[model samples]
Target: MIPLRLKIETDAIEPYVVRLRSFEGISDESHHTGALDAALESASAETAEFSGATGNLRLFGVDPSEVNGDVLFVVPSRGTAHRLIRANSRHNTLLVTERCDQLCLMCSQPPKKQHIDMFPFFETALLLSQKNSTIGISGGEPTLFKSELFDFFNRAMSRRPDIDFHVLTNAQHFDRADLPILRRLDLTRILWGVPVYSSDSDVHDRIVAKPGAYDQVRRSLSLLCEAGAKIELRTVLMKPNAPGLLDLAKFVTTALPFVDSWAIMQLENIGYARQNWDTLFFDSSTGFDIVGKALDFAISRGIDTKLYNFPLCTVPTDYRAFAPSTISDWKRAYVADCADCSLRNECGGFFEWHPKVHGYERFGVA
Candidate 1:
């Protein structure tokens, strides 16, 4: 696993985004004012010195090679730095806010009443992102602050049109009122990942711990489709909604055919999920009949369907091709039994926190 935040000692007082510069010349100097020179040749891997207009700073307890050329958000008061854009990483995500209205049963990032607005810093970080990179915008729910979020998108995309964004939202906030602004944006460059658990309203609402969420999500999705927006319908598979997977697939193909793709995902063992594991964790390793049937049904209807965060071995051979390595590198991991597996490179393995004792029952070479 890779660390996202590292401790640093800097003299600067304000928050600023700076791209680390190695011995080589900077690639795109127009995005930022000055580069923080990263002394990668130093003998110690634990700490390295970085200097810029702000002053010299030491990044302690980290390998210099891992962060060289990465864009970092330095906060002097916290004495910590976040890698907003990694030079070597293909996956980059910016967490917009932590406040959400819905309290889902398996929310990986649990909601908090307090939210610190990071739109300004995120906009600057987006400008410093790598060329033609697809960045992910995730949160408790990004649409909570719809106005500022829209403004951030407009400003960031206007300056960096080459970058594409995949924003994760609950799809409960959008209404007909947001059509004008939504239509004006470049819909082709943005893909909204909206979650729809089940076709049954009672089941969907029960899973999210919100009343009438199913109807609201359907309405919001219709609005998005009318606005010519690209969307990726996301459904996290769990025990509560596992049986209705096929029904949801049928509903998606019949009622929401405009969705660009449908992604069925596994639950991560964190946040609220950790507390509800016994009831929510569905072991698809041995019981993949329902999931496979749903994928087949969606694919037969000409809808692009995929399985996210599922290890290749858990899926049957016929459906293995549909499961890509979708886990982000930072939290993706493998077990000792997988060391000798022939498909380790092609498999997503598991989440770093996936329970080794009571997790997948069937584990072997594919």
Candidate 2:
């Protein structure tokens, strides 16, 4: 589901639908070409002079690099176009690294050993992101580049003082030394989306394929709480964790009560997850009652809870409101039965990689 349109706007700039055209595809009347340098070199009377560059090209208030690819859009005012720098169809998540220490069975963006430094790209991305829009920081594990990560956060905070940050980390790398750095940042809106797979340390450790990951994350959570940092603990629901979901909820309510929110999410069938479907996939439709019970218990205890990536048809009516449209639009899809579903507009549907072999038997109109 590649989004056909992207809305780009700034504080004073009216929104514009990002128009794309290749260098060869552009008409003589079109405003842009492949490189910003090329646009400058080949200025003509009919077309608006515009050039495209992946990361460094700066024009019309935006670094074309932040746009990711060739883009054609005009701004009524100068400097206002910078707001579109981090604009993309999916939520604005600046992927900081592909390296990770833990290996979860259902990891979507699995860890890579290759030398891929995203700090520079992220620096430009953070600078270009909208000041008011929530910017997400993600990775195979963001803390791999701790100094660069904290530096980027502080810079982003100063540049876009009003924007909030949502960072997805395993929360295993947080050490006592990192506490002072976290305190330095304006953390009111910096949310750490940490994953805690199970109540048992052994189970949690096994899920992440790390012997002491559970203890590490537990320590990190305590450090974050002590620093007054906002935390959103996430659990990716699957066969291994489903039976213990209620226990995990209880653990959160009792041991980790300082967490701002709890997200029990459906597994996204992609990357390593696709290969491990037989082992990891669980039909939520058949066991929604258990899921609901876990959620109900958490909510009853006044812990903010949310259902991520669960389809409306598969969730109980009582828990429907907690289920947000969680999948990125580019990777989201709907089956034939979704055509007549009452909540189709609000549903997150399934991941594009979810094959029919693993689909739910109870899929239909809600």
Whole-model Cα lDDT per candidate? 0.87, 0.74
- lDDT agreement of model 1 with the native: 0.87
As a TM-score, model 1 comes out at 0.95
Candidate 1 regions with alpha-carbon error over 4 angstroms:
24-43
Residue 21, model 2, lDDT: 32
Write down the TM-score of every candidate: 0.95, 0.80
User: Model 2, 1-366: lDDT tens per residue?
Assistant: 553223332333432323233244445786544322224323233322333342222233333333343223334354333222324554656667788999899999988987566555455445444447787788888898889889988876787787788999998788999888989988897999999999988888988999989988999999999999999999999898899999999999999999999999988888888899888988898888778889999999999999999989988787789999989776889988789888999999888878876467666789
Error of 1 at 85 (Å): 1.5
Q: Any idea what lDDT model 2 has?
A: 0.74
Model 1 steric clash pairs: none
- Give the top-scoring candidate (TM-score): 1
